[model samples]
Target chain A: MEILLSLFNGILIALEPINLGLAVIGVVVGLFVGAMPGLGSVNGVAILLPFTFVIQSFTGGATSPMIFLAAIYYGAMYGGAISSITLGIPGASTAVATTFDGRPLAMKGMAHVALVAAALASFIGGTVSNVLFTAFAPLLASVALSFGNPEIFALMLLAFATFVGLGGDDIPKTLFSICFGLVLATVGFDIISGEPRLIFFDITGFSHGIRFLVLAIGVYGIGEMIWTINTSRYGSSMSKVDVSWASMIDAMKRFQEAWRGTLIGSLLGFFVGILPAAGATPGSLMSYGVTKMLSKNPKEYGKGAIDGVAAPEAANNSASTGAMLPMMTLGIPGSPTTAVLLAGMVIWGLQPGPLLFTNQPDFVWPLIGSFYVSNLVAVLVNLAFIPVFLWMLRMPFTILAPLIFVLSLVGTYAAYMDMFDVWLMVFVGVGAFFLRILDYPVAPAVLAIVLGPIAEPKLRQSLLLSDGDFSIFFTRPIAGPITVIAIILILLPLFKVIYDKIKGKPAEA
Target chain B: MRRAEIVTAVLLGFFSVYLMWKSGEPPAWDPDVPRFANIGMIDGEGPGSGFWPFWLSAIMLVSCVWIGINWYRKKSPPSVSEEPFLDSYGKRTLFFVGMGLLGFLILIHIIGFYGGILVFMIYYMRFLGRHGWGITSLVSVSLVVFSFFFFDIAMRIVLPKGYLEPLFIPLYDMFL
Candidate 1:
């Protein structure tokens, strides 16, 4: 009852004119920033952090400024899906899984369904996570604290195993792709020993390593565009992007088709987000893999499954909200954006952790109140802007194609301020095109690179603690069960083969 | 398609082997530590710097060989198919697009992003796309102007201006 009263009063304070107006502006700014390649919520909030001081000086409390930043964080989660669906290039790392099915939906002229599913799922995910946050903030933060190195590595292995077990792609090719990406990620200096490794031809650029955006934009933005043009010969399926309002209305009514994915993502993403360093990316990805593994028609995934688009979209938004749990209650940032938000709190002279709620109910409730408010505004703004987004898809293939190429190049350069990366991006794009033609699944490779840097260190640290014993993964309380599951997932195909042989049906795929 | 599959496998296999060799090399600062020393655990440290990449590359090499065996047995679809890897039309399209991109990169180094963007857009719209010069000029010119304002002035990204640096000086004097 006390929680209810605090929340209700918090909602009233959040609805104040200054706070309400700031929410609108922040959401708009965040939406654009998140939808742009090489920019995400972190960049948006970091760049605009200075502006919040001005807001603070006027409002004379940290609540207004904090509300504005939180609104931007919420809005950016919605916007990340925009580029993932329409352009096939993820606007942020968090939305990477969306491209697996979202791009195919766009190609099939059902972009409305993908876009609508993404937006509605995001709204549901955000709201579900908010309720979970309001109910279990302290409990979840304590739970998050217990996740150590071995557990995190086990989770990472589970993510990769899902792709191998449930992914309908060729086995050797998928394994190869995964290995190649992991190796590529190790090109820069070794984090533990501070030793440079695999500096290809000793180019100075190799010292910084291969950046994620370089590879992502290369494969999706440039390679996919070129492949689309080659396959369609310009009169292709992508050119037939549907822009009718009827589809939009129909999409709203038919969103229930993706109910399973939405539910899985909402629940899973919130839990995953509460764990520090495991952010929205892995949450969305794990949700994608889990939804696919459980689906009766697993083949529908990566071929325009509405559930595929919905799952990741929902997960990213849900996880963004869940990420705040640790920040508010434990004084620990669950994700990079939350890290920035923590900094903002520190500057505001507010002490985070268990006492914040007791000492500063005025700040706590209003901030929680703003999460609900910002999520509502974000969905409404996204829905209203649907027509404008669809109009860009109506462009001619030749025009759109060059624009994508230019953006891929310019965005890469802008990201690291390195011309070498721009050239490497083009090279990777050409390589991706060849790999795509040969039916090599590049998605696993993309996933591997994203997780590799994080995975390697956890593995080493765990081994170190256990005196080089591999059993550390299988012996720990939390890590044991997760590790066993991952091993089962990896060996699922071999089990199938053995079963098939016993059944006298040992046929080649 | 069949032959291209084998060739690609062979090339990738070679690349993987090269990576394995490079991974085992000692850090430049401590060359006397011996090659492949970093491929496993050091005495005091956990795993060496080369542990992850060296093992991963070995797996990649094994996968490539598996691909080769599949190709030899005519098991993979690409191995069995009679279709050319890229037909005449695909070849022509690839050559033109590839050359255009190469030219754009060169132009970026020579004339910077703004000037490079202008030329590339005009070439793409007018020549490759077969649009009218009037429309191409209008669209391309408008894009350059919008980019200058958005990336340079408003965001303060300061994209290189190349030979056009002198031309933008007065504008920078006015704005920046």
Candidate 2:
């Protein structure tokens, strides 16, 4: 009853004029960003983060800016399907599984059916995850309120361990990326001792530390754009769709056949998304695989199966919302996009952990309430503006690429008002581009940069209490199991190698 | 591709070692504090500031060495692949894109963000994109104007205008 009353109040606050207006605009902007090839929610959020300050200034609160970004996240999930169904290219990685059956449906000249299914499934998926998140977030946050430094550090360790064990990237490269990001966060002055550290060449810019925004924009904005341009091989042709009312109604009727996949995706995606490393992309792909395996006509899985279209679409949307759970409750970001959001929360002068709920109900409830509003806005805008998004997609990558570069450079400068940071960001972008070519995963690094400052202090504090004894982590009941699990996760690759050797299997990567 | 993998690992290894060394430096104010003195627990002060980053960099160095070993064993994807690190088209794209970005940054130092954006857009749209003057100019000019208003005037961010500062004074006088 209490939860329902709070949710109702949150909804009312979310419906206020300014917040509602921001949601609509944010959803529209997000739709276009998500529909564009090589641009994802992360890219949209990172580039536009600086612009949110304007909204923050006017509102005198964090709720409006957060709603804007969250709406973009919701809109991007819906928009990724647009390019997948229409242009035969996944707009974002979260939409990759959509292309498997979405393109096949388009090729069968049922593009309208695929698009509607995707949009509807995404709507259902998001709604399901929102319900789950609301029910679980307060409970989890209350539980996490008891977490001490050792426990928090252990969770951080587990998060990093998941990246190494289950990230599916090269283990060493993943470790290198994580450690490098953590190290970079140590630049500028040390918070504990007030000592200057890692001030490379003693540049004045190093005094304030390398902001997370600079690294995020460089990696997602510039590096990812360069990667896309180099590797882009998408076909130019698009599937034509009838946007008439009759066709949409017919597509809606066909969407009913997708209920099973939607149900599976909504449940599985939420669970998978709650995990530290397994986010929407893997969630969607896993949902697709599971749905296909259980299908009555398994061979039709990637051959215009409506379930195939629905499963991944729903899963991605569901997973996106699910990814917010840990971020808001425990301060552990479940995905790279959520990591950026976590950083934003810190910047907005709010602590992200369990205390957030107790300390800032106004900020928390409205943001949660905005999630539901943003989902509704995203679906409606997506369905109504399909033709517009398609036309926007045809605007050519050359023009879009330059615009992104301009946004990235200008956004970095605007955020920090530092020319040196701007210069350093470009350098980082170029270096990131090189690292990307070698199959280095940049997401871990981005996540690390955000979590590092939080993790490091907790670790030092924990050790300080234990008189420099490492066993403090192992002795505490809450930290003990978590530390053990993290250790196992970190060593899983080694175990796999040993297992393979014992089984006499030939070496395989 | 195979050769690039080991070379990168070695380079990263050295970089990591340098960071570790850099992390151990004493504070400038108290130069007499021994090196690596701050990388461990103080008697009563608890863990020093350098403790975290220095250890993290050591892990990075170890990770780099592990990457080298993986490369030696041909276990990593890049190490076993026979493809060129950057094909001709890849090389050309990187060169053009990289240089274009560097040029944009260089332009910013002299002309400021708005001016830099205009030149970069024109260069990308006209020369690189092969778009005609009409659309390119229209788009570029429109963007610059929008940025100027949004960033400088309305938001009061005051982006540097470089030599173009004088020209913006009239507009600022009119707006303010």
Candidate 3:
């Protein structure tokens, strides 16, 4: 209740005309950033992060850090959806599944409607997630308090298992990629034994560990470009996606019919986001799949289904907020974006554990409050400006492609203030292209990299707590079921193949 | 699928064996180095901390082999054409990798980050795409300006100044 009141106070602070203006500007800029191919939320945020440092240098305070960071966060979220619908190019990963149907809808001359649905779904998801945050955050935080190292370890194991199972077709190859990620994580100084694993290069760059800014930008950002060039694959040309009152009415009706998907997507997103390693992409995929399964017209899916766009967009936004719960309560980052937020917390000299609520009510509550306001703002901004973004589609790729290239370089350079990072992006991008060819999925590698370092220490910590007893994984009630479920999922495909062969039935991947 | 599986199995088997052989050697350690009793059924103090990874790789190796054998020994033959593997990917691969390598080589030299991007984008968007000069020039210039403001001015993050350092000084003064 006190948290709610504090949130209210924060909302009041965020409602200031100045902050509101900043929010509008941030959302607009963020949308453009997201719409551009080769630039994404991480790049958007990272590109913007250094400016905050500059702002601090000029103004010498952390008064508006949350506002700036939140704006970028919300803006990136909004931006990612634009390209997916119109251009069939997903600017960010969370929107990959969105391209499956959103592009089809655009092709059917309903691009405006699809865009509106996605933007509105994003709003509804964000708002509902905030309400849930207001209602259940303290409760969720309290629940996390009971989780010891063993439960945490089990959770990481589940994450690893899910990455292998859900990421792609080849389980063994995915596992191999994951193992490679784990090996990469093992580089730098070991936190437990203080032993360096793979620092063969005695260079300072290898010492502090492989920065995600470097790796993500390299592998996904640069690697993707190289792969695209290698494949010589040309994107389908975009058409003018004009917003009309008729389309707006049509979108509203579709929203009415698929409101259930939005709600379910938000709920699932919130739940998945609450778990560590269960970030927006998985939440989006799960929500998308579940929505399809429950839909009356499942056949319409992957064929311009409005619910398809609504579900994943809503899921991604809701999960974005969901990711905050673990970050706020447990002091553990639930996603890379949240990890950046954690870094911000450190930058501001504010600790992020349970005590964050007590100590920095002024800082925390207002940020939470702004999330509510921002969602409303994002929807309005998107609806009113749909034509503007749609106009971007008409711009020749010749113009847009170079523009994207320049942004990519700038984004890369800004993140680390080093050309080495930019170069790294090229290397990683090229490598990623090859890996894609070999059917080695990059998402699992990323997920594994994100979860690996955290898992090792937690497992070691659990062992020490239980006096080296491995049974602690199963002896605990909360952690055991999750572990069991993960293991079952891993075996499901293999068992199904066997069962089909034995039963003289057809096989399915 | 059979051929791919066979290749994977062979690769995994070879790599796993190599890893175990290489990592199994005892490292020259200081007295302060931590040691744990090996828990494996292998002779002597069993495998060390590195042993688990080796064994896990071995299991992966075995699994790959099993899957490969199962695929190869299956009674049915593949039905459809597998022409995707035979398609021309070489030109694209070389250009893509070459472009990326060039991006690195040119960084911090004549063409800075922004300049390098401009060049890369022109070649990619114009030469590769066969785009008109008007659109390419506009996009290239706009990207550079946007990047400058976005990264340098708004974010206060510095990009590589390089040879363009002189030009950046004035812009930096204006923005900073």
Candidate 4:
């Protein structure tokens, strides 16, 4: 009953004219960003984070700005399907699975059907996950109140371990990328002793720590722009999309056929998204795989299978909402986009975690309410604006690329009014472009940069509490199980190699 | 690709070593403080300044060596790519775009934020993108004006004005 009243109050807050308008703008902007190649929710959030400062100043509060940012995040999940269905290219990594059947449906001249199905599935998935979050986040935050420094440190280790273990094919490269970020985090000054560790070369701006905002914009924004320019074909044609009222109804009727896949995706995606470092891409892929395994007509799995489209679309959207649980409740971001959101929360003078729920019900509840509103808004806007989004693809890359570059520079500079940050952004962009070409994953590096500073303080605090005993992490019951999980994550690759060798199968990288 | 992997591995190995050595140099020995005490715990108060970096860099060095061994054994994934890293078109595009960005950064230092954006957009849109003069000028001017209203006039956040400092005063007076 209390939860219902809080939710009702949240809806009332979200219905204010300015808050509603910002949510609409956030959803629209998210759609445009997500439809563009090489731009995902992470870049969308990062690029728009500076604008939140402006919004906060206008509104004289953080509530509306937070709502706007979270709405962008929800809308981007729905928007990522645009290119996947129309052009056989995924606008974001979460839409990669959507391309399997989505592209085939387009080839069969049913692009509109696939697009509508995806939007609806995304809405259902996001709504369901938001409900789960509403029920579970407070409970989880209350439980997390007992976590001390040791447990928090152990949790961070578990997050990193998941990235190394399940992130990709190359464990060594991923580990190297993560260590590189940690090294960067150690720059400026040591918080514990106020001593400088790695800033001895005396560069112009070495004393100030490297901002995650600058690095994020550089790597994800400019680095991706460069990669897209290099790899994309200059002028490609897109499939024609046709949607009408009759076709919409027809598409709705088909939803019953794929309801099982949608349900499975929502369940799996929500669960996977709550785990540290597991994100939408993995959730979507796992759901797609499971759907295929359970399908009676497995032979028709990937060849324009509506279930295939429903499964990943639902899973990715649900996973995006599910990622918010840890970010809001535990101050642990499960994905890069959430990391950027966490940074925004910090900038707004709102510390996320248990205290946020207790002290700032006005801010927290309305943001949750905005998610429900934005998911519905996305479905409506996407359905109404499909042709407009398709026309957006016709814009030349030559124009789009330069605009993105300019925005990245301006956004980075706006963070602290520092020209030095602009220069740093370019340097990181150039370096990241090369690393990307070498097949190194950049998400782990970004996550490490955000989590590294937090982990260091907790680790030192735990050691101090234990009187410098190294065994303190393993001695505590909560942290001990988490540490064991981290150890297993580290050793899992080695075990895989040994298992493959013993089975006389060639070992995979 | 194989060659790139080899060079990267070697560079990382040396960089990690340098980091480990540098982490040990700070807070030099005193009679009251034991040698390397800063890298360990400080009288049961917790780990000191050098603790996290020193151990993390050691782990990095080990990972680098492991990468090097994989390279030597010809077992790395990058060892098998026969294609060139970038084709001619890709190389040309990257070079021009990279130079344009570098020029923009240098210009921002001298011309201020809005002024630098104006010049950079004109160059990027007109020269690199090959847009018409009208489109280029319109976009360049509109973006600067919009930024002025958004960041300066309404938000009251003062952007770096460089020589254009005087030009924004009237607008700020009218708005603020």
Candidate 5:
């Protein structure tokens, strides 16, 4: 009853004219950005994050900007399907599974049907997962309220361990990348004491620490620009994207055909999304595989099966919503996009944890409210503006690239009115470009930077409480199990290599 | 790729060692106070300033050494390939675009935010991107004007004007 009342209040807040307008704007921008090849939600959100400062200044509160950013996140998931269905190009990595059947359907000249089915599936998945999020986030936060410093430190350790274990095929590289980020995080003044840690002898900016926004824009925005330019392959044909009442009715009729896959996908996606380092890419891919295995026409799996298109599309959307659960409840992000959102929340001075739900119900409820509204807005806006978004693709990259570059520079500069940050952003961008070439995951690095500050303090506090006894992390009941899980995750990769060697299979590097 | 992997590992290993060394350094030293006390626990306090950083740096050093071993054993996946980091066309694009960004940084320091954007856009579009002059001028002029109205006029966030500071007085008087 309390949740319902709060949700009602949140809905009321979301209905405000400015909030609604921002939601619409967010969805539009998300769709346009997502439809662009190689520019996923991470890039979309990072590039637009600095603009939220402008919005916050206009609105005089963090709530509107939060709503706007969340809406963009939800909208990007919806938009990612457009290119996958039309051109067989996954606009975002999450959309990769959508191309398995989506392109086949387009080849059959049912492009409109495939597009509508994806949008509708995405809508259903998001709405259902959001309902679960609204109910479970508070419950989980209550459980998290009992967590002590040791337990919190254990949880952060588990997050890092999971990234190393499941982040990629290369464990050592992943560990190195995360440690590098943590090292970078240690660069400013020591939080415990007043002395600076890693400040280069005379550089003034190093004393203040590297801003999350600066690094994010540099890596995702500027680094992505360089990557896109380097791998330019812009000329491609797109399927006709005309949606009418007739096509809508056809899609709705086919919904029954793919309902089972959609259900499986939504449930599986939500579950996977709750786990650290398991993002929409894995969620969608897993759903596609499971749906294929269970299908009656398994041979048609990759040959334009509507269920193939429905399953992954549904899964990725639900997974996006599910990723928000841990972020809001425990302040641990489940995926990269949520990591960015977590950083945004921190930047707005809204700490995302149990205290947030209790102390700032206004902020929490409204954000949850926007999730429900934004998903619906995304579906409608996507359906309505298909042609418009496709037309946006016609805009030349030569024009777009320079514009994005300028936006990045201006945005980074706008954050602190500092030229030093702009230079820092460029330097990070260059480093990020190199990192990407080496196939080292950048998300873990970014997450490490965000979690490092929180983890360091917790570790210090726990040690203080336990008189520097490291066993405190293993003796406490909650911390014990969490630490064990973290250890197990860290060892999993080594165990796999051993198992592979025992089986006489070529061990994976 | 193998060479790149080795270089990165060695560089990270050095960085970790440097961090460990730096983490042990205290702000001050006195005969009355315990040496390297910051990295250890105090009698009443649980841990001191350098405790977390010192331990984390140690862990990082171990991880870096592990990476080095993997690289040496030719067991690292990244070390298995000899792929060029970037092809000729990609290298050209990176070089020109990077130079453009460098120019942007230098120009921002000299010409101010809006002025810098104007010149950067014109240079990037006209020279680097090879877009025609008309479109470049159009984009450059519109971006400067839009940023002026948006950040300066509407939001009241005054960006750096550099030498163009005097030119904005009348506009600010009208807007503000």
Candidate 6:
């Protein structure tokens, strides 16, 4: 098939020593970022985008852009495990359940095992997903070409409903939070009108733009710092973080046991990644859940189970790959990182849509192929850094706090030259702090924000195209089935909750 | 969770009512304005382009209220009123957040965005993390300097330089 040949060509381009080097660097950085508590994937990638701008300017090639974008994502994957194993915190929502088992293992002096499993699982997921993307992306893109605006709108709605309903806490609050994000998105420019909607009386940076980085860093980074300072039991902090070759050997043994978990994770992640709203969080959560349900030693789950580590890590990586499906095919971003990638594409004068495959196979294939190289690089770097990363946690907070604080600020400022970013960070932090008190899940809020504005336009476009026929949603077979699926997703949680209550069982995690 | 839900419900209700006012009041007679052609005329005529978002938001608002009412009537124990607000964990988080906010407010004016961020990171890393001076300094300098060159100079984007303008110019020349 020409598609297959093109894909092979992409591999050739992606495997270029320079591109390969960048891919490796991305995975290495992704691991470090993923390991850090609070930095997580989204903020980690966002913080790194400034560097990408520089890369793009100097090289003026698609390779540099792909390297920057892919690296941030890979770094985020690496970052996710750090907090999970060491601090009992899943750096991102997707990895939340990882802490249940990972932290316990670390406490039991198996941090190295947890780290190794995470890395291996992530590597497997990333590599497998890249293969899947290469094999299936074109076929999927062809199918996507026929999708009308109504289908797109329905998909967005499905994503919104599923996230709002299934995300950790109270649905109403989540919707409200999402609405808040939509409001923020609408602040500067009116997409169709090209007129300012909410830009108030002239401020210095107001005319140029309001970068989302400012908001994300302010909320998650600075706000998180404040929240951490307020809540941390430094008195209750980990007593020890020891790394050993023996522990790593044990981790390898655990990985051997969790081969099924890695496979399941990668498969589920791939499927979820292909879907519009199913991102790393759901991918990780679902993989972890399925692994637990199917495990022979179910009791070991949530109690330092090695498979627990593998499932979520794999799920996260695979789902990240999955998130790219829509971006590549439909020009719709399912996740924030992908949204940033979309932004990068726009900046490069390349629009992401059905035409991407035909118009710029040169650009597209290499990026997809590079994912494989990136995943391999991630594994190598993560393995090397295992002991080093583990040991770094033992360093006293006196030295760690200031450095992270500075990195947070510098990272924020680097995204854009505005001090407004710092302020935005504080605002988000304050809001996040309060929401934490209320058990309001930030992920849904974020998901809502990211997807809301996008869906709104699609809905309108669909309506316009259909001459206001709402039936198009149900009439078009592809759109109709997807809508039905969305409906099921919305109702599934309600039914599960009600059934649990009737059965005298507590809510499912 | 219940009381918070109640408040959210009320707010949604209010927002919906507000949207009703906002949606119908878009400046009229613009040729560019789009409208839905058919919808059985919810009121007077078929809904306009803004109709779906506004009405859907309104429906959401109503649903939130219903959810709030159900929780209030059910007397859910997990409600905000039942739980201690700002638990110990919450308090600790607030302090660091305060430090960040205070630092930004004060330093951005005095040191400029780049300097303030660099200083903020160094202070946080050293004070809060208790990292070594070497790691702290190296990370702070590299991140700040590299980002400055990348975003400001190379990108031709301007950063806010309160008192650090003089320093930034020399750096800009070297990179750009």
lDDT of 6 by residue, A302-321 (tens): 55888888988898888888
The sequence of per-residue lDDT tens digits that candidate 5 reaches over residues A13-112 is 9879999999999988788666544456776678678999999999988899988988888788888788666644456667767776786676565776
Task: For candidate 5, give the lDDT of residue B162.
Answer: 84
Q: What is the lDDT of candidate 3?
A: 0.66
- Model 2 DockQ reads 0.54
Q: What lDDT tens digits, residue by residue, belong to model 4 across residues A84-153?
A: 6665445676776676677667656577678877888898889899898888886754454567788878
Model 6: share of true interface contacts reproduced: 0.26
Query: Each model's interface RMSD (Å)?
Result: 1.2, 2.3, 5.6, 2.5, 2.8, 5.4
Q: For model 6, what is the error of residue B3's alpha carbon versus the real structure, in angstroms, after optimal superposition?
A: 8.1
lDDT of model 6, residue B70 = 52
TM-score of each prediction: 0.97, 0.71, 0.76, 0.71, 0.69, 0.69
Instruction: Give the per-residue lDDT digits (tens) of candidate 6, residues B80-128.
Output: 3566566656556457646654876688789876787677767666766
**lDDT scores of the candidates, listed in order:** 0.87, 0.80, 0.66, 0.76, 0.76, 0.65
The TM-score of chain B in candidate 2 is 0.95
lDDT, residue B10, candidate 5: 80
Give the better candidate number (1 or 5) by lDDT: 1
DockQ leaderboard ranking:
1, 2, 4, 5, 3, 6
Deviating ranges (above 4 Å) for candidate 3? A1-19, A29-72, A80-118, A163-169, A199-265, A268-316, A319-369, A385-410, A417-424, A438-440, B1-67, B70-81, B84-86, B89-93, B100-110
**Candidate 6 Cα deviation (angstroms), residue B119:** 5.4
Model 5: colliding residue pairs:
none
lDDT of 2 by residue, A370-421 (tens): 9999999888887887556445344566776787688777767766688888
Candidate with the greatest lDDT versus the true structure: 1
What CA RMSD would you report for each candidate?
1.6, 7.8, 5.8, 7.5, 8.5, 7.1
Which should have the higher TM-score, number 4 or number 5? Answer: 4
Residue A340 of model 1 has an lDDT of 95
